[model samples]
Target: MTDTSDQLPVPQRIPSGIAGLDRILHGGFLKGGSYLIMGPPGAGKTILGNQLCFNNVAAGGRAIYLTLLAETNSRMLANIQNFSYFTLTPIADTLSYLSGYSVLEQEGLEGLTALLRSEVRSHRATLLVIDGIVTAEQAAPTVQEWKKFLYDLNVAAEILGCATFLLMQFEEGPASQPEQTMADGLIELKVRSVNMRSIRELQVRKFRGSAFLEGGHNFAITQEGIVVHPRAEAVLAVSPAELPKPLATTEQPMRMGVGITHLDEMLRGGLPSSSTTLLLGASGTGKTLLGCHFLTQGIMQGQKALYFGFNETPAQLMRKMTRFNLDASRFVAAGQLELLWQPPVQDLLDVLAERLLNAIQRLRVKCLFIDGIGGFQRTMASTERLDLFLTALFTALRTLDITTVCSVELPDLFSPTVTLPQTISGTTAMVENILLLRYVELHSQLYRLISIMKMRESGYDPAIREFRITDHGIEVASTFASAEAILTGIARFSTVTPGVPPAFETSARPLQEQQS
Candidate 1:
């Protein structure tokens, strides 16, 4: 039989040399296709185009960078000199930089197309970058002439087996542009001002034959070039079945102790490895202390841990933990723990997620603690993305088999509601366990109460227990036998019939007996 597979030619792709951008493109740009890069004057379109050219030439492909703007070649080269990727010698030999301004002025669109064709063929270039299409549009007296020029340019590129990038100053949206219709792909870069701060974003408006991540991803202009950070919500790769096997012994299912004896008894032993728990409470309700206990437990067990303190500085966290007799400094000094403290305001969610994932992989961390999840919501531009972002993050941690504890603060300190705050609603569905800490007022005295609200695939104590932060550490009492409505912030005893036992009698036992 004839081999029909040989009749189909292999598809070709060109790497943009930007890791995140390539990922957003679902691989890379299709080879031998024309793409349009549009943005405002200072949106880094020219820089992106040039960076692609340099990266392609470095990969054994010749490229031409032709500019039709008033900016001179020397000025452009000098501007790019500071970038790490801008190499002088290789750019001089392999890549060609030519000015199309004079040609467009002398012979109009026809001469510009002819010049592009001549240079692409003479240099045997596989990539061509036209850096000033807006100027070319100004030169075209009629719309038909502009369309003809674009058609000619595309035909020339296809015939010569060259991939073309047309960079233009797009002041407005490109929804109605005829040039957009002709190009095989369109990439848009934008700089938006929010509360007096600039945020750079990139979007793939069109990729004719390929599926790309369809969203505005955050990007930044660094010393190297434009680096894109894809939104975590758009990319969900984590799942329990895909989790890496535990690095330690595989003889039994791994579990991490919660560090509190009574809490462990309530949890039936401890949290399962790779599970995520959310500690929901109000301010000054021992959430941070609980997270410290979890991390300290992991460190004591010889497992690496990471702590992302969203609101507290490292020193502040150390001082606070010291009050509870937990010394995080020693573990940090020994490199068994990583403590990162970034102010939540003006922060990008994707950037934080990236840093967290990188730390988990680099440290091979098995335990993670995020203090101030309520403050984490302040970092996002919109509250709607918080759920998706947290879901993706927890999934990624689960895939790495990292047990995590995140603390979220409620709005009303005295309210008895157990739901998440408005800013971070719907995140409870992603959590494998939920612990609620609340303030209780009994007999004109303020006390702390703890409850295991929910536990997936496991049984937990259903009674509300009173806890105290002593000089040594947190001490958990058995269920509050003296109160009936302790969780409502107002505690009182329930009346009972003379012949029957009180309701609190069976609901709680002594701490010593419960632990045993």
Candidate 2:
């Protein structure tokens, strides 16, 4: 037999234990490499170092943390006390922290390099973190000497199969540093203020052995250390699973009801299943009510459902359901239905998407109702990411076969300018269906009109209908074809009667009698 013992084992990764961060790092830091973490003061560098040490120990690996700057040990440990990863451990066997300022003072850079090598080998450490690396740079006699010290430390680390991090303080400024090119990976953290709101972001400039997400991802230093939220477009660039196959019929796929009897007929059966639908309307146009009906109908049909809203709390929503005789609290309590309500406040876009997707999977949901998608736009720090964000979000929804309905509030109650609303224009092309609800002026009175604007693939009735929200939920009446320019929300009829209703408004008017 041939000798087969010469093969080397493949290197593994060291997880940071920060939620949603490993994905951005492309499965965390690769073992046997050195990384540089640069940021200003109070940017969570110390928190990250301790968090990584505890994570490595929890994974059955040893770690050594060396600090060169001046700080009391109690104050450093105080910041990491709240997180679960900061549990006390046997210092000799697991995680060990020691001050290296004396070694660097007495013997200089060469002595520090030897000290790091000695400590790592003695502890059998798989992970190492050198906090306050800038002190070493300032102590070096020359820039070339600093670079040499880094090269020696990195080589020793790789040979010993240990992943290393050098934490350095840096003010927000330009990049062109000498040490940046020498490290195997470089990560930068920043806190920027936009419109009086602070946004914390992380960016990975370079990685040697892995391909990482390239963008400024949002991060927060909560009680659980540092939690990063990767950009949605980058993380979900491709759908997690394949989308459902199309139906055999020509342009006709599966259809699900919109909860109203006559509206389903107007929809030529119902909205397309596993499709994204947008409800375009202004405030008080029954958008939330219509979404409630959609979720109620799905729950009644024994399909799991989710209602994610920013404006309404669970108590408020349950009260509205009671008004329509649709009691959903029972299903909600049974875990068949879930209500995910985030208050209208500043939030990370990718964080919301993470919660949305996780809830869908938790409930095995089939129908989804987003009460006000424009709420997300209002809370976002960057407006340019709207198009790509929604496209990726809806693509992931389709991959899970979720029939989604989103309510978008138009700026005006009635207008004829033919302009897309700034909040929703980026999402029009991403959805499969569009339904319009607007107030049309007729006979000195405002009447609401509902119409199907577009059905991308399915065939449907294009007639404009008058819809009413009564004590019995949404009721769709006959088509309002007697007036021209009804779509403009300023209807014009040939009849001159001011008080009397038009003939088309009469309930006795036959559906066949209306304009085809």
lDDT values, one for every candidate: 0.82, 0.81
lDDT of 1 by residue, 1-516 (tens): 889887767558888889889999988887789999999979999889999999889889999999998899999999988988899877777899999999999999999998999999999998999998889999999999999999999898988889999998776664868789999999999999866778899999999878889989999899989889988877665655676664555444467987887788888888888889999888888898888889999998889998987778889888877777888788888998888897756778788888887888899999999987866677666678887788888888787778999999887677656656876678788788999998765455565678898887577788777765655566565445533445443444333344332234323222222211
User: So what's the TM-score on candidate 2?
Assistant: 0.90
Residue 282 error, candidate 2, Å = 0.9
> Candidate 2 lDDT, tens digit per residue, 1-516?
756787666658888777577988878898989999988888888988888898888888999989998985667777678886778764656888888899999999999999999999999999999999999999999989998999998999999989999999865565656678889999988888999988999999898988889988999988778889998889778743466666776556778788888788888878888999999888888898899888878887778999999998989988888887677788788887788898877788888888888888888999999988877787689877877888888888888788999998888877854356675677898899999988665445566678888898787888878765656677676555532344443544333244332344433222222221
- Cα deviation in Å at residue 260, candidate 2? 0.9
For all predicted structures, in order, the TM-scores are 0.87, 0.90
After superposition, the stretches of candidate 1 with alpha carbons farther than 4 Å from their true spots are 1-4, 171-176, 237-254, 482-516
Question: RMSD of each candidate?
Answer: 6.2, 5.0
Q: Candidate 1 at 121: error in angstroms? A: 2.4
Candidate 1 Cα deviation (angstroms), residue 61: 3.2
Q: What are the clashing pairs of model 1?
A: none
Could you tell me how far off, in angstroms, the CA of residue 28 lies in candidate 2 after the best superposition? Answer: 1.4
- Residue 212 error for model 1, in Å? 1.7
